[model samples]
Target: MLLLEKGIGGKSLLDIVKVVHLTKRIIPLFWGAFLSIFILFLPGRVWAIQNSYKVGIEDVLSITVWGEPELDKTVVVAQDGTINYPLLGNIAVAGYTVKEIDELITRLLAADYLVNPQVDVMVKEYRSQKVLVLGEVLHPGLYILTGPTSLLEIISRAGGVSDKVGNQVSILRSPVEERKIKDNEHASTSVEEKEAKSILIDLEELLKGRDLAKNIYLEPGDIVFLAGKKDTNISEQQVYISGRVQKPGAYEYQKGLTALNACIMAGGFDK
Candidate 1:
């Protein structure tokens, strides 16, 4: 009551309430205007995002030349990150950005061949960024990594781990990771110092419980291997023949091994 009596500039409670009400109305107007401007600029933002994607190996490209159907053709990037075009034979398109390659083809054709070549390059399919997911997961194989994906997300993508964490889920980031690091490092690391890096993830910690830290981001070409269920592995493994057997104890497990064969391996069942 005392604070209300001593309101801003000796204003009464009623005056303060009216001012707050006015402020509430004005805030929505400002927000609406800001959102309108932001919405208007969204198309440009999307265009920029699309323009920033670089071309890579195995990516299908839809390239067309305006007014010249003969020169227009869709091509896939080769293993060496190159494309075979009419004028440019075996042009290296890998590593080079889409815009760069577009300008290059345009310039090359105009210089020696076409008077004014019009080139349009668009990625029909992106195949360069992918990872290999193998082992105990339900669906394990090559997974396309469209964006930043965590280990946990990948496990879910592979239908989760076989059995929580019976076996370790390891990521073998070999020459692929090493090559990228060397490329970004400006060759700071020598060949001798460069080594393949590996990461072992505990799926039990993640699936069975909360261990957010175990979720690490994966890179293209990384191999994520999840081991099979420990219980299944144990059972499907060695077959033991003991009680009343000639030679008891554990014995090697061979497919289609009957009880008699097991007894034979154990020096024949005891009479």
Candidate 2:
């Protein structure tokens, strides 16, 4: 009985090993199939997200009406957040999404000109809402916003922070009321004199994910400026170790470096 039990136990172990090996071989194929499906559906998901993006000023749009080729037109949103469509005159579409625009145009066309008109709206170019990122960041420049973008997202789009980035970040945003007044052409000189509101954030806390509230959603026409650790230029960073030191010359200056360390790097004392 002992011999039979031992033989059965050995067979069970062999079967377990074979099953584990088979599972290992099958797992890769299963993941490959899953990844293929994900890849196939990624473009559709991206299109859905982009389609929901609100139209803004200076954004180029392509409007097409089915069965009416003459009605197909490419138009650009004006500064006042309006577009001129043929027979429709000036239509406000700054804050409306592409789907909303399509529905609106379809409804208007059916009400007056055509019966059951089908309309399609597509964003040809994104130029309306933009933010400027500068100072202590890699590739600092202006970036266009597709949707609701956060401060961190714009910073990431500018290629993240540089090595010399400091602990503080400043965001300059125009007042909402001021912008509204300006848009209406009723802004006074006093409103123009009012500077943009400055928001200071602790970069250390933000980067560590400790103060998530500091990662506020950025607005269009906002300016982001990142502070630096030192104001000195890289070319001007040098330590002159001349007195009583061997190989005394200009040594590269680094943060928290002391005179003793500089002397040591210069080959110690002259003796």
**C-alpha TM-scores of all predictions:** 0.50, 0.60
Pairs of residues at least 3 apart in sequence or in different chains that clash in candidate 1: none
* TM-score of candidate 2 on Cα atoms, chains taken together: 0.60
Worst lDDT run of 10 residues, candidate 1, spans 14-23
- Which regions of candidate 2 are displaced past 4 Å? 1-52, 176-195, 230-271
Best by TM-score: 2
- Model 2 Cα shift for residue 136 (angstroms): 0.4
lDDT of each: 0.54, 0.60
Model 1 has an lDDT value of: 0.54
